[model samples]
Target chain A: MARTGQVKKVGTALAGVLTISLIAGVVFGEGTSPAAPAAPIPPVVAPAPFSPECQGGSTEIVTESPLPHVAAALMKRRTVRILAIGNSTGRRQGGFTRQIERLLKQVVKGADVVIINRGVSGELAANASLRIKNEVAMSNPDLVIWQVGTDDALAFVPLDEVRETVESTVRWLKEHNVDVVLAGLQYVERVAQDDNYYRTREMLRDVAAKEHVMIIRRYEAMQFIAAAQDAGGGYGPDEFERTEAGYNCLAQYLASAITVGAFGKGMSARPLRGPPGSQPQQPPQQAQPPQQQRPMQ
Target chain B: MPRQSNAIDFWRGIALITIFINHVPGIYYARFTHANYSLSDSADLFVFLAGWSLRYIVGVPDRPQQPIGYLVLRLGGRAVELYAAQILITMIAIAMLAATATILDNPLLLEWHNAAAVFYDPIFTHIGLAALTHHLGYFDILPLYVVLMAVAPVFAVIDRYAPNWLLPISIAIYLITLIVPLPIPTWPVEGQWFFNPLAWQLVFVLGFVMAREDGIGGFVRRHITVLRWLSVPIVAVSAYIVWNRMWPDPTLMPQPRLLFIADKTYVTPMRLIQFLALVALFSATYPYIKRWALRLVEFGSMLGRNSLIVFCVGSILSLAGQITRFVYRGDILVDTVVVVLGVAIMAFAAWLPEWREQVRLRRSAQPLPAS
Candidate 1:
């Protein structure tokens, strides 16, 4: 009797299941395979316009080689090669690495600069250090522009560890005789107010000075622009007024400064100041015009 | 078993409340003080809770007969209710819009004035379509809930027949959804879409499986400390990534790859892990909070019991409050008054239906010896 009861229960449950399935089928099965073409696959290589900056110097483009085990390739009687490695910030259209490529191409004049962007967002300094050999060395570029540290600051990686990581990275590049440009990032908002930004910047600066590699004062340039805007009566209320313009100006300044600092003399010769020792004082030069002088209102 | 897992429902109620707070449009404590909490995070939590709750309520062994039928009815009923509610609310919104146009003498909603052009834009049209389809508004979770619940039986069968293969299948599906693109259109072009099912299903599955396990409650208790400690780094890393990537653009459309990876649409891996971390942290510290909340006695239990009613009414009230904002034109005091009054009125509205039902039940229970 008990066995029969169990069987009856199971049968009832199965019947219920079938009924539910039928209902679901009726509801969701409508247009189950709606007529449409397959989605288009994104192109692997997006068409990028070459910049006018890479025309005058010995510019090395670092990118992944197409054919394996080919150190240098002759494509239509011109060598095509590139080295790509860094974080997501390095992979943007206007990111530091791309800017470097544009400038390098402009300096070399008609030399095809194949700059590869291997920047994955959210990568930590430790991860970069671990992957340096495979991602950077394997590419075998003549020059490497290593832009990192943003993730490290937010990750709370120790200042010493950040310096050690960068130092080792530079050493590895130098071992392969790969010229290195160690780029520094500047403060945007809260980061500028915090002590960690300055500490990280100083650590990078010290490493660059010790290693005799090129140091780009990206942070100082940002401060200069921010200070200039603040001095000229505060910038607008929105983020675009505050950081977008600042980031663009800073990025432009960094690219130009790195090129100048590494290869030749340009605007980078100007003295770079550190973060304010205390709360920022009112700009030494105040706003002049009466129209601009409206009180805090 | 009669599915002795009401604990998850309590947690789900809390998740729903968080979602309600997130959907409240105007500036509140969440805006100025805790702006870091994204609307996406709330959606992820809700999806996870939904999956978890399904497993708890429906997938137990030695269960009642007609489980699948019961589940389907419950889901279908909720969907129907949602559609009906949305139609009513949309009409109310349209009416409110028309009334405001009259009061302001703006002619924004009047077809003759041609100011209806703005009102007839995709924002309203899409919301209108959503209402018609029973999809609710952009922030509505009911449509996604309906879809997820419908699929639960299939998952349950897989759980029963091939338990060992479940995790691998789920992970494979999740990875495919993550790497491969699935383009689903959401309305308003710029308005937020609440949840995505593809990435989100993993959380639901995880919750479902965890609920089925014999030692889940004990396991949670045992690993509380380790889980709490682990949450710190997880939160920090996720926050850093979100701050760097998400804050730059708050708009819903033209979503970047990071948003896809975050996957509020269908509970992506990152969201699942983050939500689990949050749950762990909360459960570990819940004793202190439970003690305090319990101290409130009558109000706490009443609020907890009628959470669904509170949520529905709260949502409608928030919309009313938003309309008042238009009427008052950004007067902070007036907005606050409107919101407070809206909340009271909604709470009262929720009480009315229940009161009527209670009265009917009392009358039905009256002695009928003469009859």
Candidate 2:
């Protein structure tokens, strides 16, 4: 009797387990082989004309090689998805994320850029690192543009941990056949002198060099623009309202890099501001190429 | 302090402290919290302990003397109180963020945690916020707690009348909800609630059911020694999995990914299992708690005892901590001072209830004739 009761209990438990499995099989089995995607339709708006402001200056922020997947999609389907994450993407209204999309449509031929901005403001790198895999798996984007390092710098996350986390995350993206672009360290004036800010910016540059992934010099780009705009400038608040102009400028810069990097060749680093503290000697700027007209808004 | 550990209060206190640190997103000490090694953090402990407390207060389902209607009213009232508390905190958080932005001369602070809603679409977002569908970051958990509270009476009745069937039904609902998603969608945003009450109800129900001395609870008590030994390996492996970032990608998993992966939002199976194993190991440590540890536990107990109020104050304190960090251009010294002071305030908040009771007693003795 005792043996029979024990058998009965085990059998009951197995049935419950089996039931859960059977239901799961029905749910996932149907979802696994997704239907074939519809043929791509060309976007409604015309691609924006290229802006001279984006022509080239900082070769450091430009992509080194072609984004193979994006390039292929551009050639065949004319459709490409980009996931923009990290803290600064949606900080401003009419965010830079949308600006990047608008610019890409305006510039790239036979290209449709759909950007899904999952930027949670004030989120640290450690938290973002954990969420990125899921975001990528769900969307399967061709490129991930992460505006990183700002929150990590503010949070006092150890430099080593920040580098390790970013490297591992970038590695994970690569393994999963997604290209990553690291947009580093928003140039905030308050923390400009803080070691954490400067160290984190340097660490990202080093990570980019070692990992060989493209790292957008958002900090450098902003600093250079502010410096050029101000006769004597070095990372403090410039005469320009930082948020509105900064978002647009960063978008324009990234858009230009993506266009050239996807279709043409990598940009050469034009030295600017001469390594931070040195007296400004009119550091070579990306002067007008003459063929280009008004800068794309 | 010298007696057997009050496991619930001790753990609740621990959860409170951890929650405070975690809420201040960029604090240096936050990295050391339980989330570093485990899939679930203090939130899970908090909700679970809430369920346990309700059961502890109401007595076992089998021998309840109070009418079911009264029990329903009490729990429903608790839900109302929590709703009020949630709204109070949300409004305060918005004001705090707004003031921070003005004081710091950085309008960007208003953009943090979706506070732009207050400036742009306050009416629509406030509707959602009041309805408990929209939650700001660091101010989310209370709404989830309120939703859970609203359903406490049903849990009580089921646990009492059909104790054996209670867990099975709750688990079945949870499993189904995980696949189908919640019936109601969040507003001012087109996604589900961050802490979906449907899925999270399982842990809450689990805590309630397990707190009893009969049914599955009795079986666990009988086999606790064996279970504790088994849990050691489970906790150890789970810790390794999270600490090493060895999580399997949930998207790569089959349907019912909630069961296969570790996620915080839905309280997925992996997270639930890992949390349970950790609890199993720690629950047995009451007797093993040293005298020195008890005093610390006692402080935590004070906070835990008056959790609702302390938690309210703690939430505000967390936002304050964030603003202070931003303002101070934080370093180790700043982070240390804020964390130490923040915890000290929460402790004082916790002690106030008992302090009030003692004052009431003394007043009653001296002032009856005058009254």
Which candidate leads in TM-score? 2
Candidate 1: tens digits of C-alpha lDDT, residues B183-233? 233332221233555555677677776665544534766676887899878
Model 1 agreement with the true structure over A100-140: per-residue lDDT tens digits: 55644543335455654444333456445534444343344
Interface RMSD of each: 17.8, 4.3
Query: Native contacts recovered, in order, as a fraction for each?
Result: 0.00, 0.21
Off by over 4 Å in 2: A1-46, A49-65, A73-81, A88-117, A220-245, A248-297, B1-5, B25-28, B57-59, B116-128, B157-165, B180-194, B248-256, B290-292, B326-332, B365-367
Candidate 1 docks with a DockQ of 0.01
After the best TM-score superposition of candidate 2, give how far the Cα of residue B304 lies from its true spot, in angstroms: 0.8
Question: Chain B vs. true chain B: TM-score for each candidate?
Answer: 0.72, 0.95
For all candidates in order, the CA lDDT equals 0.46, 0.68
Candidate 2, pairs of clashing residues = A47-A105, A47-A106, A48-A106, A59-A269
DockQ values, each candidate: 0.01, 0.15
Superposition error at B47 for model 1 (Å): 2.8
Distance from true location, Cα of B78 in model 2, Å: 1.8
Instruction: List the candidate 1 regions with Cα displacement exceeding 4 Å.
Output: A1-297, B1-13, B32-40, B62-67, B107-138, B159-170, B187-194, B213-222, B236-267, B295-308, B349-361
What docking grade applies to model 2? incorrect
- lDDT for residue B156 in candidate 2, whole number 0-100: 73
Q: What lDDT score is found at residue B325 in candidate 2? A: 82
